[model samples]
Target chain A: MKKTTLFDIISPVMIGPSSSHTAGAVRLGLLAKHIYKNTPKKVKFTLYNSYAHTGKGHGTEKGLLAGVLGLDVDDRRIKDIFNSDIAKNIDYTFSYADNFKKHPNTVDMVFDDSMFVSGESVGAGEVAIRKINDFNVKLTGRYNNLILVYKDKPGMISQVTNLLQKEGINIAFLNCDRNAKGQEASMIIEIDGKMNTSIEDEILKIPDVYFVTYVEKLEN
Target chain B: MDTFEQLYKECLTKNKTIYQAAQENMAIEADISVDKVRSFALKSLFEMKEAIRSGLISKELSMSGMCGQDCYKVQQYYKKQNSMFGKLFEKIIEYALATSEENIRMGRIVACPTAGSCGIVPAALIAISEEYNCSEFEQINALITAGEIGRIISLKVALAGAVAGCQAECGVASAMAAAAVCQLRNGRVSQILNASALALKNVLGLTCDPVAGLVEVPCVKRNPFLAVHAITAAELALCDVESKIPLDEVVDAMGQTGALMSPMLKESSQAGLAVTKTGLKVQKQVFD
Candidate 1:
């Protein structure tokens, strides 16, 4: 009954075979690409449980690799993934893990031997990346310019807000996830914002801020 | 009965009755009895050929017909030629004929549910169609029987993309094809529904992940396997066997299972296929 269902049925173009195994994989990958610090060089993908077993057949391998390469799901090159020259540009390998504790389609990616991104393909173009490298965060990437980090001492939120205000950006939603007051915690800020190259530099410069990343919302 | 339960029951009973009536109408030849379901399938096939040969359906139309029965619902797909159902219907029959010809030539066939999933259904459907020269009426009867099975799944397991992903799409398509095969083989409607239930139950949470967000890559080939699976399940059911639970129960279970399924597994491509590294790469390449 959801509107997305009708859109999917009505969409003129859909990649072959299955929707979840292909389209959703690309969306998740695109999110990760935006979040990563740089274009990844060497990537290691650890597929947990069912993903490790049946993923290859479903073209998850191509889907994941294409995502790291920052390709959209509609690209025709996806079919040539196994033999693409672009795929050669990135060093990628896949392995399986026995972690059922994670979602069935969980993929833990180690990007360029630096950033460790862990996420699950929830289904139908939806994903939740629980961790990006060491920074712990949960986001669906449904909108543009999402920022998450560990909340620090007092005035940090105010300072962050002032910095965004200086950049002529407005905050749409700022959600903080904390265990206890004054303790180390996480915050997710969804904003009507865009990272203009300097945004990352500005946020990373903040003390107590572990890391900074950007996410662009995918169109339905 | 609960809503899902009642729907499943209705599907099973109706499917059974239609199949029985169809089978009872099949005329025999050469010391062998033809199946009503096969007869119906063959008739559909012949009609497709006639439409194509008479220019009511063209090569393009026939090719589109390979997409199966669902194509009729959205006639605007061929807006270049004008949005017309009459033309679309002709094309639909042409595609069905072409698809059938391709399957027969390919030899190892897969029948998509009815001729709709003919690419997959016939992988199983033609095997029986060829085995027995079933008439067009019998094929329609078998399709109606299969439709009941499909309806049961739609009510219980979900035909909507938001629910069970591509699993319900092609998976249910395969299940329906298998049930029709059972009917053609003279299996009781209960048996036919059982085969359908078994097929759906076996592949419950399959995801719909079209690589590159296009319905090209795995979608075309996947139908054939679904057709093959339908045949396998039907054969299993016809061997004096039935699901320990009735078809309706399986439908109910499939619906609940789809409900509990994650949104990622649905057709959004945001999850299984859309979220992968390769998925992103393909997407970027496309948009860039």
Candidate 2:
């Protein structure tokens, strides 16, 4: 069973009209921003289904933009984020689509025409970052995570786990997906301890490693 | 941790009230002190109060011009004539509207279980606290009890209208409020649990059928109605009324009911009130 804290139920003071559409959108954006690791010059947001239908009234667009700009969900500026100076610094656009295959409240944030992060507001104020780029992954932003894209190889998993074990870090969850044998693969590791640049650098040192990014947990 | 039965057992064995057990367990899970847990609840409590304060005076319509004045209208009505249900009833209704309207206007509010149902717990707890002159610490304890109720129900079903319809969102919020109000009134642990059970048992299958797919219309008005619904549960529980079925069983039934419900009624706006003629016209006016 998932261990839900008391604070999870009663808290997360936020600007809202809907948790799934508004606050949850901000969280999805925050996770996407963390995965991207840097502010992109432009972002294209494709809102799906319910998010597409009622997103404007719920301020889903504003929440997504404000989050990418590093604003917390409770930030009052989210209501008028479009007029904020921070929003002016970046180029962003919102497009709508209907995909019954996707979660009702799903969004894809494409940054600078390169990185694609798709997430869904799973209900309450919780969200899951389901896809980063083309790699299918699961991230709930509940723990410090290390995401790596590398060539699929036999020793990749052991190599990564060995490093984490040496550092006395506990792995809460880990998922690795590859398109085919010995092809491009993605590793998503949720850890119970803190993460730093040194740990990320060690993962990058491994041969065939293509990309590495550390995603910090979202604040409650 | 998964069931209210376990929570009751833990509380009994540990000689703690529902809030005490909940706070201690959360403190251990989050690796924070129990005081820290209380402090977090306290912060949310203050924010809830602030939302009510801001909402009470503002008649500003939402971006869609659908809601945001109902709270003002209710306040005016109450000023001219008191509710037959009394001042506590009037306060709960007025505060629930204020907080929910504030939410539609993009104002800050504590998402008790969820933003759509944020008003219920605050309206019930704050109104009762004021009526009875409860202390801040007592109010926090009541709030924590409410949180535990929500947290437990959420374990069985995700508290989202899209997931389990409004039964999980506003229905659960009403249950949480019942638990909080029961605790405030010095009810026993069983009574508090029973209060929540009554609330949940009664609101099973409440659909998430907001008109125009917005959190207005039924969503805004539903807050006050459910807040009052919570009081009814608390009143019954305080008088030693039992829910026949256990709280855990009620939650199980709710989960099953949500699963059997059609997808169209689960925040999709394809059925129920969302697709009514007036609902369709409003949708066109707002979105087109």
Candidate 3:
């Protein structure tokens, strides 16, 4: 069928030494980082299916640790990350899970904190960040602009877009997921433009917004 | 749009059969430039040497220079738990095992253009870079050249795990290695790609079936051999020995050969090492 996008079609940097282990682990880790934001006081990373059974062998444990530590997939620091100070901040464990919706290479990461996120590494370093702290959101790690976690309020979608439009930022793709009206919701806006700190600050000012995070594509 | 299909059509027209184009594209990311390749490769080499010097990667484990059972020009960095390669060697083994888990999770594996021999290219390239102090930008460029070579092989022969077994894995890795080396030597794109295709075509139809289905056995040990082969293949191609076989035709032959192979020959753990008494016993032990 349909031709996959560059991000969709090709991803050179992956878990390391292998696309699945190095790159996928990194993606899964990045998702973990995105959702958790601040390092988890403690991380009960249960590797379900393939992750739990083979995590330690695959460096998934170290990779997962590095991802939580906010390391890129290609960062050689990832190899040494386990011994770093950032690593000491969080306590971690690895286990496998057999049942999951996405892929066998699935990992169900649980952060023992107020906010949590879970994701799947489908393959080729492609990741689907499924749930963040129980808020139902699905996004590929390829989002180049802003990440919005908020409550589902009327006009909230356009409100976020208008702010970006006024800032001279072009929206490449906008994905929004709402669990229930007036409850919790999430939006991932991929922009053709870079986001400065002001854009992030303005978004956080919104009443229903919980928190905001932005990742630059070239950073990886 | 038409230009995109040109690569695919050439692969098919020349009788070169590949696993999937979408998969091959995984190696063509924007960051994988010539400079990046040199940086990564040299960094990898430097790291390997540092590990050895600092007693991280172990001399026995890292001091690979052996010919193995299957291929003639094969070289392995370390034996399976033999010698005093010690902790670092053990760590590498552990990392090799984890790679399988990573592959299963990541949706589209490039195999770095190879599913079976995926670990070798990166390991070797990175290890070499580490030992030599190459920059990241340089490593990325070498990788780009290697990726192009791998793509050429996908067009020329097979990069699949099942077709040529570990030969395809290690063999193509060597080919990619050769291309990378050629590029490092300031060779042009055509020379690098040709070298890669030649390296792969020369070893087409190697089989899979890791002993006991573990990424260890031949998997872990095979990397160094491919790493060296990559060097040799690059050197040979650089010397301008005409292989005569167009890259596409050879890849097609690899595909046909793979299709003709018994299921055991694939990564299925059914044949070869998987059937040996020790293989069966180890497999049973793992499951038990």
Docking class of 1: incorrect
Per-residue lDDT over B13-121 for candidate 2, one digit per residue giving the tens place of the 0 to 100 score = 8788999998888998889999999999999999999999999999988988989999888889889998998898899999999999999999999999888888999
- lDDT score, candidate 2, position B24: 89
Model 3: per-residue lDDT, tens digit, B1-288?
Answer: 112235546545654322123223433543354344334434433433332233222222100111112221111333433436444333333332233223322222234554445544555455445445667655655665565445544443344464446555667667766766666665544455566667777666677776544455666556555665665666677787655765555556666776777767875567887788977786666545
Number of the predicted model whose lDDT against the real structure is largest: 2
Error of 3 at A81 (Å): 7.1
**On residues A47-143, what C-alpha lDDT tens digit does candidate 3 reach at each position?**
6665654454356677777887777776666655778877886788766667856565666677775556677766545567767765656566665
**How high is the lDDT of residue B89 in model 1?**
34
Counting only residues 3 or more apart in sequence or on different chains, how many pairs clash (N, Cα, C under 3 Å) in candidate 2?
A: 0
Q: Using DockQ as the measure, name the better of candidate 2 and candidate 3.
A: 2
Top candidate (TM-score): 2
What's the ranking of the predictions by DockQ, best on top? 2, 3, 1
Candidate 2 residues lying further than 4 Å off, grouped into runs, are: none
Give the lDDT of residue B212 in candidate 1.
44
